[model samples]
Target: MQPVVHIGAGAPGARIRWGPSPRAFGSGLALFALLAVGCSEPVPPTVTEPKPPGLESEPRWLTFKCVKPGCDETLDVTIRQVGARKLAIKRVVLSEPDRTEYSIESELSAPAIVNEQFKVSVRYRPIGGPVKGDVKLLVTYTDASPEEGEGRIPPGEVSVPLLRRLVGEPVLVASPARLVFGAVSPGESRSLPLTVSNAGSGNSSLVISAVDSDEPTIGAQALPALGLAPGSSTEVQMGYAPQAAAYSEARLLVRSAGDMVAPVEVLAVGTSLPDPTVAALPAEGLDFGRVEKGTQKRASIEVVNRGGAPLELESVRVVGNANLAATLPNEATSLTLAPLESVEVMVWLSSETSGDIDAYVELTTNDPSARLFSVPVVGMVTAPHAVAPGSIDFGKVPKGWVLTRPITVQNEGWGELEVKGLTLVLGSSDLFTLRSLPSLPLSLERHQKLGLEVEFRAEAMGPFQATLSVETNDPGGRFLEVPIRATGSTCAEGCPLENAVPSCVGNECSIASCESGWFDTDGEPENGCECSEIGNDPGSSCQEAHYLGEFPDDGTSQTFRGILPWKNDVDTVTFFAKDAFNWGADRYDVRISLASADPSIRLCVYWHETGNHLSECYLENENCPESRSFQRTGTGGGDDADYVVKIYREPGAAPTCKPYTLSVSNG
Candidate 1:
């Protein structure tokens, strides 16, 4: 057996000695040796130092390529545990002195072993211009001890700072950001230049995929895939072609390849020319109708510009008739009308000859289609002819009774008739006298008639005859002679009633007829039909109104005669409405005029159904008559509407028996 040598624990250079044989020492020696080794100051353990925790990132600096403002770019930073110990990441932080443009998206959660890799995602969004920031990783070494259960022991964390710079910027810019093409006519095309450039701070080139327009009418010139170096620009044409006149706009979008930068927007604007047109009001033409000869009639012709552009009127003239003339409203020969504007041309027709007139007002304007437009001027002039009955007979009039007969002379021709003279023929009966003769040299228009009344008084029973002469300016009938005749009869009793004619019935005097505005109210013959219109006033209220019968809707004026005996007397008269064929009883206008020789008569009108006063009391005078007019619409059904007119004397006026005439007409 080989003997074993044991070295005793010593400070330095300890001696080695041979121990007894294994047979002789046995287990005791072995135990002693083990105790010797255990009892001696335990050799200081050969301690092995643990490797320090270390982190190494792939990219030391982060660089982000942002296309434009408010654009984000992400970059992944791979962190690896290079040391022998495990490492834990406590936190990740993004820091910047100015604006915060960087953020950590994802980070490692568990502790990393040796050679283990983890990633921290960082996102960068540039506000504007050049921007930079830092990313810090807080990490510490993890403990090597085992955990109580299946989990690892919580490591005492000590954060280690890691920083990286982030840079983000824009690369493309547009020059002359807006393009305007002004006043492009319809079916016309116009274009303006737009510039696109690369504005990157670095040496990178900018690639534009396309330049497009949003509007169909507005477009940009086609460009191949273009690449612009930094600080270099390229020009493209922005075009506008309008099919019709209108305002249009569009955006010229410049898109970069790969969306490295935001799409550059260039606003484009344009306008199209407007068209001008001329039109005439009353497109048919003007007609003077039947105008009186030797007189002038005036009318108007309106020239309008119906389009969106200004219209130029060259000249307005009248032709085809020497007497027809046309003048602009301002007497100017030429004028300009704005869009949707109009100008009136005054036209006058005068002639001494009597005939149908055919003329035209010619208008010259800048309207391409209607350069020469004509408005017809048509009218007729005629001479007046006197028309009268050859003779008028009064039949038989009672003795001591007076009566008047009408001698009507009308102008049946189409011109003014001047009555030069009206006289009784020489050597005519003295019993016949002309009464209510229209003043000499009276004028009458076409279809107008004048009444020359001949009054006959029966002083004694006889036959009266006279010849009335009427001279006028009628070319055919210059002078007209109308015979007036009346027979007077003897009555047993003379008619003594004022304003009453006597009728002898079996040798008794009775009332035959009373004068206008007078009535025979009392039956007694002694009074002799003595009741004037004032004696039986119509009424003072609508309920007691006296119906004056329905008036026609032909616009013919009718006169009603009445006498006011005293002051404070009111006469209410009602008339049923006639259908004007305008929505039932809706009358266009109802006019009532009051006139009297005494100038003290006043008039008032009211709508009877509603009892609403239409007109306050108005006093009449020689120059200006009192009148009231109203339009009754939606009032009644057809002829069922009734209107009341009240007549009275002016306040504080003296009582008199003067008669008044109320003229009423509706259209």
Candidate 2:
């Protein structure tokens, strides 16, 4: 008998009865008979249902619509796994009829496992009109291996419907596919009319959406989004503005609401003229080679017009170095140049002196691109010469004292200028002498300068005037006379350092002897002697300000130096002009600079008569490393004018003295 057990009972413990058997009867009955025996129920065999094919897709249909312009139509289909079995997507393709307009955008050549998802992109083109088909996916999968019968499943085709709408099929036609605007000036414009018509169904709405030109210079536009019924038409005007001289080609893109058909393209052409272009034959410059002094040379420049329109020549003149002259034909004063027309203008060079002839042939024309043209003309006028200053002044000299001054003599002509001799022609020859005359036959090249020195020894106190002549190879003349004037003085007994008194010096504008080892270098007596030595008290108040006197000449600038003595100390330098009316409304620039390790020094300028502050500058603290500069560029005054520059230190600055410079320059 088989063993009996409580089966199918959901309980932890149960009673079981065992039937006597041959093997059980023979077991050590004596020792095992006393053990307790129990019986339990057995569990039945579990059965599982087979999984169906696993391929699935979300939204199993794909639809494409070609409505928007300049863009393709596409849709996505998702293939997902649904069951507890492995599957593979082998290949995906579109139906035969849809292959012309649709194609799969994803590759499915490799095997895909279970629970995997795939997104397939379907692209559709509207060129093949409206179409409908199915997206067929070929899938290869496996059956359950653990359960009975497991093998490679057969490949099956899963179809998903694909719908496409070639949104609108409006027949858009643009008449005369090309346009030409014959010729237009740079600033002129021309316009032409274009017609767009739709010969489709009345239910369709056609938008004359866009009209664009390839060239920005060519302007075009159409009635946008023009709603038209079948057999209807509208006109668009296109304009062209030629900004430069060129043959411009452009294209017009006429688009409809949909990419229903290819865009109607219109070819456009325009021409803008640079009427006349002046081309010089040499293309660079005209050289009259070598010309002789007091003679003439001739050359010509051909003016050619390589353009589509007439070039009008207004005038031709000579500019630059005046040694050369340019002459145009009488007919060229005012002439027109037809397309590819050319003319020749005669240019002449005549020189009265010896030098290089550098001039330009300036031609004026009506061409838009080029209005004025300059052709260089160069030639060498052979001669040799020297130039001397008009006059020289020894100023004032002391009695029985010898003095000397020098003037520059420049070679103003080409080649070598031969110096023959220098002689005293007039005045007291006994008092004047040539320190060292130029060596005989001294050759001076072009642009070379030499200094000629003259000496004067005064034997008595009186006024003296003399003329010294310079002999050179210049053809203009053989002798160039330079005048010299001076006065001699002797220091009187008890001579004091006063403007009217005798402050004896070797020569005027030289350092003069003053009491206390003081010397005057600027020839100004209004300051009681202005000195450049350190620690000299030039006065620091408006009343005791140093008088700088008048500027020596128009557009002359003077620079002077002074010192700041103590904190809160203001140093004043006053300037006066003798002929302020000569400058008219012209402005002057007055700059004052103060240099110091301490940055708190300030410079201020004011009108002496009015005491009005003009400008001031100063550094804030010691951290700043720059110095302060005060400037005034505009001032008005009477004939006898007075202006003052003041230098002061800020309140918190150190009391140490510092040196500063004041400069007055032309504005």
Candidate 3:
């Protein structure tokens, strides 16, 4: 059997025995009892803190590099420890994926102890590593005592996300390297489109920090936020405004966030053209020459644009004479014109009063040089009056025939006038009477017409004469005279022929005029007789024939001699008539002694077609003895008839022939 023995714990090489002698047992018991009383509990084991491997007592900054192509990202880190030590550290390790993708530039390993600042540098093999996952450091430390108990520091892990610096800043690429606005006009603006794109790879996000222009005339603006995605584009509008006419330039600066050391510069260039010029076609003025009163005239002026830019007309107006007016394109408002465009303006000149007419038309425009322009208009006005035919006559008519003639009086002045008294003056007042006499003091305005009528009655077989006197407020005269003459005779037997010699018929004296107003000094009938010293008087036949072309339709009159002193003394005249219609009483009228000085004269109408006497009349006979003038009217056989007027003294008791004037006329 083995015996056990106990000694003091502090004793070195203490032993326990099984079969020891009684003497040894007795001695061990005594020692054990003494040692037991003096011994105490044993002390616990010491603990130590854990730190990063090979990184303890160093600055905590850790650096990492992004190894991606075109990527220059870096990461820095600091390691630290906290809390009371309670567990033992096993090792310090990096997360699995992070450890494979990133490499630490500094020396750091597991199971390391760190009590102060240290530095650790890490590099990312791929650009995506820093942005994707977190690389963590695991710190494992123990606080355990062999003699006391198992006590250790708690396990700790720190995760740090690597920051991504992305690629080379916001790599902005402009579609066009320069901005250009071609030719521009002054007071105008031009714009062009600018495209900015981000051209970067990996996890790079681009941002446009700013866009600027150095020139005041140039401006730039971007739509939405300046930030853009990889391969994304943003548009910018660039504007240019030129103040003067010349070439211009500017610099457009663009800046982006991140690693760019300098901003992008774009050149802007433009040119400004001159403004438009306005001018009129007539360098002098528009003239509306010679316009009468109460008349209107027109003139035109052309407005032209002669510059590189548009010209605008603001307004147009007339500045002179109240009678003047103007019309222009868009007269009430404004008119816009393109380069080299033109328009015409119309001007009117009028005169309400009698005088020279003048006016000016002014135009307002947007031309730089000739802003305001004018044109002139000129004209003249004249006065007015009117005069009618000199006389009215009712031609020869048979006894008891009545004839009427109309006389038209026109007012030729600009104002109204009055016609006063009208009366008949004759050797026999009852011979001529007014039929449709206008009222005395009759009113007539400018361009107005009035008519007066006078009638002649051939009640006797003799020549008669009378005159119509009219009084009016005319500038020429207050009194006007119209002669009336005619010869009246019976339709049967024609007129009585005078017989100067008892042996010869008085008709023999109607032969050639050597027998008229001529005496043979030798008293020889065989030789040609010599003319008397007395010439034909004014009242006697010697005057040119009066035109009775339209007869009564065109009223006319003629005065001639109605006297025959010697035997067979005669006066002859001619006339043409368009128709065989009656003028007032007849188509043809023959009046002898229109002055009422002699009523014994005879009037004969001889037709050229027959070469014979058509009619003969002596208006003063029988009940017409008081009548002085003779009137006889008759119609021809056909249209366009020609007639001859033979006026002479009628053979009677009185041997001496009285010189007298006669008239042939139409109503």
Candidate 4:
């Protein structure tokens, strides 16, 4: 017999029954008899389903739009758990070739439990040009709970790779970014050719919406509108037309549609022309009012074209009086004037007999209103004349000193001379005075004379000049001028310092500055600059280097000291190496050392005649010693070849007062 087990639905219990079977009837009947007699029914085994933890991302991929270079764009991504169990986010990072341009702005705590949803912000910033390729976002996480459902999910960390795509937009570029219309007339215009091209990466075409200008005088025009494919170009004309005489500037803005690049600005500049006009100095008229008989009086008129156009002078002449004469510039009969050009016309009057004269100067020009211009000239010839000393000089006088001189006024012509007044004119008039002048309107016959005195007082140091005017009735000598000059000095004996500039301080003579290559070492104004730095002389050169005595054969060092008197000043000295006592040794080592309190001082060694560089040394700190060693072939009894040593301040270093010492010895 065979036994079978059955589970009841109503209660948690199981029942067993036996079936007829030849193979297992013996054992089955024995097991059934024992279960039925010794044990109760076996309870049914309990069972339950397992739930695993999982993570779900809001965005599977990231996309960024870069409007222009150096523009930043930002986006956010959400992460949450979809399964029943929670997950911990370990870390988030960006990985790519151009990963530097992308950044993760959101801060995430390591091993954080994600029960709800969390957001991660990402930003993209392009530096220059077009950005290419994509970046990957790597999110690393691990299971926060233990294994479930008989180890369905392994206990370890996991990483999810997310992709980001970068798209480049269209950019506009212009050749010859600036336009210059040098000079344009008021009614004319100038244009410069410009080529516009698309410099972006992608299949998008650059479409220009409008071209605008900031100034009315400047404009831009494109041929057949503006639409260029990638790596394609179009021609444009930049124009400038000014309405007046002035400098103008404008910015031409090239606007595009849906372009990542900003509007391109092309600067346009130009200048306009000015109108043509004529002008003249002494515009009223020419007046040779009065003059002495047998004397000639001259006058001049300046004509100028003060505009942008040319001016034509058909003729310039004197037409009225027989005594009047006219002379043109360069003795030309006709003249042409360029813009802002000028010329002078000379006119004179001469007559043997005494009488009144009247004349007019005729100027024929291309001026619309004034076709023929006339300038009136009037004068009278007289017989009386006056003469006096032309000038008086007081020479150099000490300050606070006074000096006086005599002036004589005489009548030399045929008629009687009438004296009106005497006056001092122009520069430093307060320093000069007229003394013992005769009464007004005094009369004197021909060959008669009048005596007068002029005094000058020196108040300050410098040159002083003035004019003495003697008024009279003479035709040519109505106002006779005599120039007077004097110079005032601080000291009566003047400055006597050698190689020094003189100055006055507290009413005492002093030294202001010393001549080149000279210094005031003693601080004494009496002796001037007594110390002369011969090493800094302009005539000193490498050929004239100073000679330093040969090194001692007893192996003792020889020391020499000097100061760099000026910046970039080089002091060269040469010395001979003494022969060594060793009979077979033909060469010996010589050590050159330098010490200075200034770090800018440097020393160099060279062959005297050949100028070949041997060695050089520079100090890193003050008072620190630097040295160089070089081999020199020695003779038995005589000195070896001379080696040149140069001590100078390093280039681009400020001049210092510190001194340096150079020592040479045999090693």
Candidate 5:
């Protein structure tokens, strides 16, 4: 049995945003003071109430200055009323005819003052210090009260400061805090749309600026020197041109005119895209030689990072709706791989079932070439009770017509696939001639298949069971056979020719033959027999077992281990190593061989939950002198998640109690 592994997949904590946005805080405060504010009382009115018991207040001011030069000026202003009944000001003269506008608003539920030149005093309710909103005022004089006048206080305008952090076209969200681009190509220039949002509740224009450290190679540019307001964001592609030098790595920085001192960084890395880029994994159509269904084959591919920087592979995944799984061993888990370094991940794309199906592997490394890499698969398993349909039903043909069918051979076993030569059995020696197609190359990929065409022709009428003898490089090939049927026909006038081989050349006939073998026949011996419930009989029952334990070491890292595929052995499996250092398991290769009581059947071992193939142990396929070579693999840095292993049986194969051995050493 293969090891079963499970991991945590979600974050463990949560919190809410309660911090006010800096841009929003500043802008909102200004808006609050401006719309509901009034100028100081006129003629220096004397204050009379120095002891209002229970009323507490503090002073704050609102300011709005366009930080541009040459527009420097003050404004004439006075309190139309001493106290707020709706605070109002008159004589609002513009410092520059172009700079002043009459704008004022009142606090919530506040009344309006109706005086002209700013009255001296009036009893007014002290608006709670928290008063806020935009106000309206009319220009009493086109000229702003001269800023040159001594002791002169210039009236200022107040409104929300439009955020100018970062953004294009849309000034609202001028900059982005995070930017992500996946799988970019060489010399590809992508315009990355960016936006800086005022995450606050106030109105602020967004301002954005881009700074490129790797100029030209990886740089930034923007329209509208200024930014945007809150809630608005612009879309722009980040233009990227990877130089031959950039064939390695690249970076871009964008700066915002905000509190952020360091600019946000954008990175570009090179990739080893497949020769022919594919959005998904493709089937290479391989030959698994010839094994059985319910078996597994193991293979590996390199995950090389061709760029200069480190690669963060969130996972090395297998993506088919099927439960087949693949993974990067712990050493490769969430690896931060340096440039040019490759990590080998284990892949299992075939199931323990049968069919001409496909398994997709989703390699989750952000390699610029191919972010998501897929290894194509072709071979699947054939039914346990059935052989590949390699026969041609070319019904009765005109004496010399030939029909053909191509059949694929697949090896889905955990062991070697043996393709013994084909034997031409005379299912119809007198009526038909059967010949194998030209010697065809038949090297199948693991779980992969190879197709062969068989031609059939008839010369006379007869019953046929084209016996196809499959000679295999596989040791147990003699036990398995393929059968092809080629029924032939010859018809003559009303001779009432029935089983003499008939095609639709004449009328159809419904005939039934009855034969009883319990009694002796006058001139025939029974070739086929049928029996009905002769006596009480029972069918075989199956059972499930679980194994979870530690691995044992025998030799150095060069040693091996063994266990049985049945009950007692199924509960425990162990492998040996050269040394005791857990980390050094990387130096050893672990091979586990499967042996069964039935030499005609094979045992299959794979990861239970993920269906990941670990190894294939043949029943009697391997016998050197007196033993078999156990398949080895390292559960390096093996732990609870990586150390356990499992073994099961292929369909049509009987369960055995023979012990399977595991060989360990470094490859």
Candidate 6:
């Protein structure tokens, strides 16, 4: 046991057992207590933040390699934190800007790497220079810890320089690779030439193939099978003949051996030898005998190919009847048939009938023209047959024209109806023609219709009556006779008229007047007074003779000779009652003119009362002052002398320029 030592209490600072000095032993005990405190005290351990593994602080080793395009390469990079801990960095920048360029995908990498493993990798893209791309990598590593040595980690960089090369692009171009020949007909042969040209800087091969128009027997020829040199060309020739009208469009497929195969079109045309001709075939058509009601009968037609080449089939298109069908029965090229080969075509008849049936078979083949041969198919239907709206009615058609009547022939019958001949009869001359319309060979199917347009033109307006006859395969309506009435015309010009003007030259008179100066209406005779015979100027209301620029007949169709006896100086006057410019014709009419281009002269006459006030027998004179206004007085439109005008060559005493009070009448 140890004793406490304190000076103030019982001991100075230490105490020990009595006897020999225990100071040394006491001090040793105190030392032992201190050591125990130091060893046994619970102290919390501190966790210090680890210092990130730092990159080797040294000059960076950067290498450049120029590849394609062979541009000189250099680098430029500024080391900002060569000595600083946080921003410490070493770089190599491109010095020659023309040879190298640097681009970072993000702005955060502009200054420094995000971590030690982050780096920018560069490679040559060969686009006229050394191209640079960026690469950022993340790696795991560790530094020396207090208790543990450094562990192995992936060696990487935030961004690292990587010298790489991009492949160089080659020059390429497209060339024609395929050839096609359009459509070719039968009996006609044509040839097409194919030329191949190399448009690329490099050479290429062409392997052509036919696509659509493949005629096995026909052969083709092409030049230069190996290929075409750069900027060179080759040609191919294809020939074939079509027995019929056909278009041969062949597709040519070409392969360039290495690059590509292009397709092109080659079109060809072929002509045919007219379709099969059956000159000796039955013209009466096929005869299907004893067809019971409600049963179908089929007839087959045998045709022989008489042309030079094999029979090339165009088509076996059926016309008319839905119940009746016609077919060649096989699906093969028509040319497979040799010359003089006979083929059978079947015509099916499925309409209701009790007697014989007729079916027309049309055969078209390698010939340019094909003839139509008919085979009669018999069929009987148990149900009844009828026709709706089958009659054609022509309403009031004018004469001298062809009347066209279009009618819809509806099949209201359970059995198909066969219509044979439809005709317009009763005085059907060359002027009247009956068109049977588009011929529908077989049945009038239920709800089926046939269009028939019939024309009747030769109509004359006098109650024309005639009958239209129609014949069909229907027993009841085999001969349909219907009445067709029309009105005919007798007069070509208009209707007849009464009191037409009759001309008479023996007395030189027409109708109510006589040329001997006598009028039937008036009884008396005069020198020149068949009043109505002379025409007056309509423009001028004056009663005067007119000489048109050309001659005009006053009473007859014949032209009257020029006004003789009156010389150029004499005035043969024509009066225009209306003003030419203003064209104003007053009811009183005032303007007057001379038909003759001469001066005005009045051949006057005297009048005095003898029997009545003016006697025709007593007033006979060749000259006098009695005259009417003859010439225009001024621009005001009246003659200077209101009634009298002196003769043109008066010489001695002139006739007075005054209006005489004597009256004159027509010529």
Give lDDT for model 4.
0.67
Across residues 1-667, which tens digit of lDDT does each residue of candidate 5 receive?
A: 2232221221111233455565676677667666656753333333556431111111111233322222232322333222222222333322332322222322311122333323211111211111122332322211123335543333322112111112222222334444433334565655566544434333334355555556455445554443444444454445555544434335656555565434556554433332222232113522334335556776665555555556767766655436256678754557666654556666664556545555556666565676776665445554322135454454443333355656655665433454646556654343334344436434443466555666666555554555555554443343345566665554332123122222324332212232321211111111111222212111121112222222334433332233222222233232222323454345334444544354533333322211222233212222222233344444544321122233333444433434333333333
Estimate TM-scores for all models: 0.29, 0.31, 0.21, 0.21, 0.23, 0.18
Global lDDT of each candidate: 0.67, 0.63, 0.56, 0.67, 0.40, 0.39
Candidate 6: stretches off by over 4 Å: 1-381, 384-395, 425-431, 489-667
How would you encode candidate 3's per-residue C-alpha lDDT over 185-258 as one tens digit per residue?
87899899888876765445566666788888887755536356566677888888888776566888877765
- Scanning candidate 3 in windows of ten residues, the lowest lDDT window is 495-504
Worst 10 contiguous positions by lDDT, candidate 5: 52-61
Tell me the spans in candidate 5 whose CA falls farther than 4 Å from its real position. Answer: 1-91, 94-116, 119-190, 204-206, 213-216, 242-248, 260-265, 268-667
TM accuracy, model 2: 0.31
> Candidate 6, residues 1-667: lDDT per residue as tens digits?
4453332221112334444246776677667677777578643444667644444311132334554343545433222221123332233233333443333232234334434333333333334322233321222222222243335232322223333333332222323333333333565555666565545442222333333345442435544444443344556566666544432334434334444444444433232333433321344555555444656777776655544356655556455445566767574323345544556766676754433333455555545454343344433343424454434444443345355555555555545566665666757533345565775455665567666655566445545444556566654567656555444333222211122222333422234333432222222121122322222212111233232221111111112122122122222322112222224421222222222232333343222212112111232223343333322212433211112212232333332222112121111
Who is ahead in TM-score, 1 or 4?
1
- lDDT by residue (1-667, candidate 1, tens digit) is 4465443321122354566665666666556667879567654444668644566555544555564456767878776665445555544454342446556654555443433767777676755433222334334445444444444434443222223222333477877887767556789898777787777654355566777788889986666354665566777776789898765768878887776688888877665637556666687788888776788888898876655567888888988888788998778978888765678889987767776678889989887778898888888887788999989887666666667777788988766789998888897788888888777788998778998788777777777788999999997777799888877765553345667776677655677887776656445443455657743457677666666676556675677777766457788777765655654345545667777887777876655432222333222221223443334443443443457677888888875667777778766
lDDT comparing candidate 3 with the true structure: 0.56
**Model 1: residue 225 alpha-carbon error in angstroms:** 68
- Superposition-based RMSD of candidate 3 using all C-alpha atoms, in angstroms: 40.0
lDDT of 4 by residue, 1-667 (tens): 4576553531123466666554475567567767776476654433545434565555655666554446778887776665655567777777674557678754566667776667787777755333334466666666666656642434333222333333445678877786767656787888888778888764455677667899999887555353565566777887888788865668888877665668888877665635444556677777777677788778887876545556788888888678888877877899888765668888878867665667778888776656786777777765777899989987766577576889998987656689898889756468888888888888877789998888888788788888988889887758999898888776535445667886666555567899886766555555666666635332135565666656545575777777775666787766765555566554455667778888888876764322222233222122213443334444444444457677777788876656677778763
lDDT of 2 by residue, 520-584 (tens): 43444423344434645566765666766665225667777765544456676667543344444
What CA root-mean-square deviation does each model show from the true structure?
32.5, 24.2, 40.0, 39.6, 26.5, 39.5
Q: List the residue pairs that clash in candidate 4.
A: 1-25
Number of the top-ranking candidate, with TM-score as the measure: 2
